[model samples]
Target: MIERRMNPHEGRSVINNGVKLRGSGFCIHMFYIRPVTYRGRIDKGQKIGEMLPMQRVYPGITSHVHVQNCNRFNVTRYL
Candidate 1:
């Protein structure tokens, strides 16, 4: 599942984009990056999207991606 919704934490127009890899039991949430892969099987090392320049969205914040190893069934536990 790919999430493209308003960030609840930010409480603004900021979108929280991310990909939930159910098969692999993990999810990758990205900030300041545009997602290109919408619906399909993503292979390893596949180009999911282009990384946006951090200066535009978050000034002074380091450019990086947030990854979480989660339980596919539970959806809350980070294991």
Candidate 2:
């Protein structure tokens, strides 16, 4: 099932998803989509670089966070 953009621009760019991000002290719009393949749609979970997966696409007003803790004590133990 190939998902074509309603209004594709600059190739894969579609309409602004109502989300705005400020980068380098400037506001910019963002859009994500999957590419059509020779047979049909792309892989299910395979990410093609910076493009976001449709199944895991994030919307505005949503909050996401991640925390990583390195608790490797005695590194030589596993060596």
lDDT top scorer? 1
Candidate 2, residue 44: the lDDT equals 53
User: Model 2: per-residue lDDT, tens digit, 9-69?
Assistant: 3443333122222334333323442323212334557442244334443455333221111
60-79, model 1: which lDDT tens digit per residue?
Answer: 87766655444324546545
Candidate 1 vs. true structure, TM-score: 0.51
- TM-scores for all candidates? 0.51, 0.20
Worst 10 residues of 2 by lDDT: 63-72
Which pairs of residues clash in candidate 1, taking residues 3 or more apart in a chain or in different chains?
Answer: none
Q: In candidate 2, list every pair of residues with a backbone clash.
A: none
Error (Å) of candidate 1 at residue 63 is: 1.3
How many collisions per candidate?
0, 0
How accurate locally, in lDDT, is each candidate? 0.51, 0.31
> Where does the lowest 10-residue lDDT sum fall in candidate 1?
5-14
